[model samples]
Target: MARWKAYFSFKLWLYSFRLKKFLGYWLAVFSVIWTFTEFSGYFFTAVDGSPWKPNVWGVIGLGIVAAIWMSRPLLRRTVLLPDQEVMLEIDINDMYARQDGAWIIPCNRCFLHSHIDEQAIVVQFRNRFFPSPADFDQVLAQVLQNVPYELDTVRGTQVKKYPIGTVVPVQLHGTRQTAYLLATSELTSQGKGDPNLNHLEDSLKSLWSYIAENGNTEPIIIPILGSGRHRLVVSRYVIIGMIVKSFLAGLAQRKFTKRLTIVMQPKAFIHNQYNLDEIESYFSCAGKFEFDSKGL
Candidate 1:
């Protein structure tokens, strides 16, 4: 009887286990879906009863939106869904220019790398922190009240200052927006950006968890992770896809209230590395946004 009870208990536990992960994924899925709906939300009238024509104004509006996005250092069009949206813009002109929203910057397991030598967050240090470069660890320790703690699951499994997949929140100099010091990769001896997708996924999972619990509905800005100095060996083609898949799979299952944007550099987009047209098509695909009609 005890054995049977234990087995039953384990099964029951699985139902609610990692509910947060479930939420994140579904919400992300919904974001894509919602954006597609918005893009296709157009209908034209035919008083003569000949045929229902596509709305020219609507098409023009979408074109204008597309033009604005293209003009900016953007790869993907801004996707607004249900109660949230996702954008792909450039941070080249100004990395920390946004007045609001939490800025997420990737760091190593130790969170002790130099911005000059390590470009993962060079933009933040140079433009955001300004004046003198920031001592990130010290900033985390003193300002955010975070201490380096050991977290397993990455390649460089060492006693480190910060936990893997967790963020150390800090405030930028000129702005009141909080800077979420998100650790996306481990300091691989092979170099930076080599942290396996599993680790990156976990870090992203941690990101959603933080937003759900401690974050408001403010906009959040993150870059195309692992595309910088760390240089993860994975093809650039899959980087955005991986991020989208992981993020949508990790958004809160119901009532995801935050706006998320992925910033891409203009040079990268212009170089034809990522097919912007394809990305635009992907967002507008009706099939990709299918979900239950429970009204999230």
Candidate 2:
């Protein structure tokens, strides 16, 4: 019964209104080509008194249309802002893949939450970039060595509390890409990840500032903030909206990276059932806001 429900859900998305909008684009293009051939006889011509046979061409056109429609789910949506200098891409892929741009790793204020499970993106990123835990820690220590921290806001077992929205950049040992660690949560004295929506917003703003000053105009890649273990009692869609809004708002203050890619894991993408078309529309609407490209 569960399997049947899942199957039906998949079918529903296959014919969803959002998918129709995408398919409409390709279908219109096909129509134009088909009409052009009818008038110009570009590919098909009448032979001996028999009219040009469109059967073969029609089959080929339908096949091409089907291929285009089926490929939609496999592709992500990308949008360029008004200035056209920056771009935003949304994709369902592995963030740990050795991409060219820098990535944002959400970390606790302490920056040393060693409880293992508490670190989701952090752990995955470390395993991919560093040889072992010790190696990653060595690099982290060096990066945070002189960084200032706050004495208050200590909760439960956490002692030294770094203020939220702290951004620290760590260059992966072997790769040209850098990992910008943003403090979005505080480690509970028990050493669990504790985060709120406010913190996430602040962290995103700080992230843009750091990127503008130090990101060197490289593309910035990030995962959906407030997801996984951080516990923001909101849907992934809302979290995505918040991230977009904050990033755009930051852009208003000053231009940051040339591109920002939001990478969502395949599991999260399917389980959450994100409608890319709707998200794309939201991005377009968000871009309409008046923004100052110059630094404030």
Candidate 3:
């Protein structure tokens, strides 16, 4: 009778373990699927109802699944230091302070300039308050002429440039017609400082041109222009969102591929105050890249 009882107890333990493993696998698969679906539904839905409202149960289930999925990987992968390769360089103070590599300097005068050897370039500012599209075009033409690279624009789509170390600008012209201008200004002010919206726009146009011409192969490098000396108040997420939106717009139009690499200088509060883990989390969540000055 005792031997029979032991056999039953062992069978129960084995069954429980197998059940736990099975539950874990499904949880991870569902969480990823739900997250992706939620994002798509939110973007494509035209109605006013909350997308998350319908997925509340799925979200909860995903959370449970994610918890289990994360645990197993914790032991296998060691979080390495943020070491994104340097594809291009921007002439920010900190970036220069850290490395003496080929640098891109914004001419503040020439709408656009590219120094291929140093893998550096600059986008000149056109205005303080707001510049018109004509001004942006003029600046871009100058950039094209001076910057030793090809320009490619298609059917009002974003541009593309080649050679991994390219300097692209994110221009912000206070043109009301331009979607997300106001939002971009608010974001710029929050992130760096007041940036010349026109310069931002011109830069973005130039960026699209570069993408269109060269195709998105090598990662491009850029600094938070208005956010720095320009004093554009904006969050990192907002800036990233704008950039991504532009990239996607180009992609949708079949202008270029979607490969992109964005770089930014750490704020004083962050560099001076936060530890490595907090900073790592911030950039990692924003996008994949190394935080070192080597790849300014």
Encode model 1's per-residue lDDT on 160-224: one tens digit a residue. 54666777767665657777777776665434445466667677777867776777667777777
Better of 1 and 3 by lDDT: 1
Q: Report lDDT per candidate.
A: 0.55, 0.71, 0.38
Candidate 2 local lDDT, 73-120, one digit each (tens): 433678888664678887766777638688888888877635666348
All candidates: TM-score: 0.59, 0.77, 0.32
Provide the RMSD of all predictions against the true structure, rounded to 1 decimal. Answer: 17.6, 5.2, 23.0
For candidate 2, the lDDT comes to 0.71
Per-residue error for 76 in candidate 2, Å, reads: 1.0
Among all windows of 10 consecutive residues in model 1, the one with the lowest summed lDDT is: 3-12
Error of 3 at 53 (Å): 53
lDDT of 3 by residue, 25-54 (tens): 667766677777777776775466645433
Model 2 stretches astray by more than 4 angstroms: 1-12, 15-71, 150-159, 291-296
Enumerate clash totals for all models, in the order shown: 12, 4, 49
